[model samples]
Target: MKNVLRIIGAILGIVLAVYLVYQLRTIFVYIILAVVLSLLGRPLMNLLGKIRIKNFRLPNSLSALIVLIVMILFVVGIFSLFVPLIAQQARIVSSIEANEVARAFAEPLNRFSQFLADYELTEERFDEHYFRAQIRDILKFGKVSSVFQSIFGVLGNLFIAIFSVLFMGFFFLRDGMLLQRILETLVPDAEVPHVRVILDNTKRLLTRYCFGLVIQVALVTLIISVSLKFFLGIENALIIGFMAGLLNLIPYLGPVMGAILGVIIVMLTNLDLNFYSELLPKSGWILVIFACMQLFDNMITQPVLFANVVNAHPLEIFIVISVAGTLYGITGMIIAIPSYTVLRIIAKELFSQYKVVSSLTRNL
Candidate 1:
């Protein structure tokens, strides 16, 4: 009877804990973001600490504040550089005439429709008029205005999230050991050493992973932008490059999406050109460029990142990303690596006796 009562009590406690966590999910997200930022910013904080002026050193709080300010400025600079380009693209898209665009692509579209019919792949002939009407509906002035308004609404929410993260990160950086001490208190005395090992390994691996990701994104963006500008004479090269690089965060699906988006943008903006003579050929080249970029990323950047920084096998990373994407979508895929890394560390620490765990985390 005592054992039954204890089991019931334990189940109730688990239920209550899950419910509380669900209710405070937003706060949890903020805390996680703060922790990541603090880890990423630790080197900067340490560098600031090394600056001593005649037996006086900057306080940790002040150092954190300076790092925060620098981060904010860097973010603001990025926005300032990209916002005008995005606005210009929005205006151009809004001004495009669906009828004209349809006329430009009519020949190739008709050919495609005939091919589909020839292959018995489609039941109805593709209708350019219907396509034009759909495009017109999408590009209507009110629709465009509403789209911009929705974007602004999302940006407002993002700003709030960013500010909250920065606020929490400042304290985390200043009191670096405070979180560790708190965790130690929460764990059983015997498990405290294991928890510390997990935490330390997690921090080290995640910090390197974060820095590696930044380098990967920047390298991809530079490669695409420079290639497009120099080889293709594409006017919106920077915007396309940035979009592709940002989409690359989605793992397997990302490069494909980026390629498609790049081709579509190039085609849409150059609708005045003959479809077969100029637009299609140019768009194909753009795709080839993006494909090469993805090849470089996969062959070079990703191998180095996974092998050295995250210290995970390529196959392991792929399996983790695939499963996470299947279950939780793009966001899941983006975070799969770091989350898997942490899980591996914890598993190795707690279950070192298991041969599988020992083998999997031998490097870690």
Candidate 2:
């Protein structure tokens, strides 16, 4: 009877939790953005606070304002420089004749068709009609539309996120410590110390992660842009590199996508060059730059900068990304590691205080 009651209670609790989550999703998004932005800006805010005292002249608020202005200027400068160039390149790509791409792929496709023809298939059936039609049908019938809808749904959420970050940054910079005290107040006396420890650890880890990401993005963008410019004379090196760096935020698959796009840009622009000899090598340089950047990020930048923050093993990280992607698409994938880290912190803190749960899950 007791076991039956417990199961019933668990089911009810889960249902209630799901309902509450659905109801509060909008509000929760704002809170999440606030937390993420605080993590991003805290280090700079703290540094400015310290330097004010050291200088004995400027106020901390003044220093912080200066930092904000400089950050805004740098972001705006990059956007203004790259946006127009990328737009122009995109127009060029769109203006190219579809026949050009078809011509490029025709020879390999012809050979492929011949290989299939030996098995009683023809080029029309294999390459032009059925195969492509089947691919389109599969996409139309399968999960592609849903995935695209979810992607656009996430894009729509960006406004809420931006507003939340701005709202949160104001209070986070001004009264973040006070907010921590208030959170501590919500916990029971016995759990307050554990909660505090968890919060402290999370703050430190997330701050380090954000800082490391910034450095990594900057370094990779510079490397890609410079290498492409020097080696290929690519006119839109900065834009291509910037796009690559931004996409690198998506993790493992990002570099591959970036490299493909970079190659396409080179191919479209260099109409005069030998397709395989000169164009391929120029495209190959993008891949080389990507490799070098990944090497530095994985070895030096990540270890030196984000050592303590992202403590999970590669397999654990991979599982988290895969699961998150499966559940909620790119937004989920982008945030998977951080979400896992936060959950781990909370679980560790709780389990440390409760021996019963710890003992039951000894393997974990």
Candidate 3:
């Protein structure tokens, strides 16, 4: 009868899990952002606690406040330096016709046309009209005007994200113990220790993942900004470099997107691309920025993870990112690593409970 009850409970749990995932999809983004923010803030919160900065050993809310202020100032500083340049570039781009710009900048397309003509390729089979229409459609769909609108839309999302993070971080930092105790009250006394272990593992993994990424991202941004100033000039460097660095947080798609932005900025500005004509086709300068970021992330970021945090397999990490991007696009990509860390902890626990699997994974 005990075994029968356990079987029934297991089946019920599976059904409940599927239902919960379907229902919780929308709220998942908010929960993830909150979790990431709280994790990033935890180390500073701990430092404050250790320093006895609170009133008579009581918790201080000021640590979270200070972190928030620093983050805002950092963002503001970057914006102040670059927004005007980007705006001027935008005006220049807006004043140009597509055909005129293409004449001025579409050398790649001209080369392709030359290749096709030289090869005596069947123009009819290529359906140049159809291709042109498709190109026009894509251009319309992804126009600079639409991109500017999307940027403004993201500003609203940024505010919502910030508000949610602060609200969640404050409570997590101040009253997380109380919340855990409440959760503990709901669990069976005998199983509470096991549950506590799970929660602690989750907290530690998330904290390391978030805090490490924050430092990593900040370092990458600083490196790109400095490199851009040295190589590209400060006229449009800060904003472009910062945007690229921030997007680099998204993984595979980021560097390419950033390079495109760099190219667009170069096209819009009065900078003398002719001087670097030899280096232009190779995109050596943009490549340098990406190479530096990749080097820093691999040499600096991954080594720190290996030294301190759990060492996830590269293939496992890739699959997690692919799955995450498929499900939630950019946001999913950002959250995928920490989410995998949480899953890895759970998987280890479940595997350890089964003798056969334990033997198989023990060597891992």
User: CA shift at 231, candidate 1, in angstroms?
Assistant: 1.1
Candidate 1 minimal-lDDT segment of 10 residues: 305-314
Model 1, runs deviating above 4 Å: 1-24, 140-149
* Alpha carbon lDDT at 294, candidate 1: 87
Q: Rank the candidates by lDDT, best first.
A: 1, 2, 3
Give lDDT per model, in order: 0.85, 0.72, 0.66
**Candidate 1: residue 79 lDDT (0-100):** 74
- The TM-scores of all predictions, comma-separated, are 0.90, 0.75, 0.77
| Per-residue accuracy of model 2 over 1-364 as CA lDDT, tens digit each | 9867855875696588658855896676577766766667666777766654444855545654565556668777978988898889878875655455545545545667878888876545445444444545544635767877887998888766766666666666655675578778976788788878888988887877777778878877888888889877888899888988888878787777788888877777775676567766777877887788778777887778766777666887899899888877877787787777776776666654457545432322
Model 1, 108-204: lDDT tens per residue? 7788888999999988777687678888888788997999899999999998999899989999999888778988998679979887888888788
- Show pairs that collide, candidate 1: none
Q: Which RMSD values do the candidates have, in order?
A: 3.3, 6.0, 4.5
Off by over 4 Å in 2: 1-26, 47-70, 115-157, 353-364
- Please give the clash total of every predicted structure, in order: 0, 0, 0
Q: Where in model 3 is the C-alpha error above 4 Å?
A: 1-15, 50-85, 95-100, 106-108, 117-158, 231-235, 270-282, 355-364
Cα deviation of 157, candidate 3, in Å: 4.6
Winning model by lDDT: 1
Kindly provide the TM-score of model 1 when superposed on the true structure, using C-alpha atoms.
Answer: 0.90
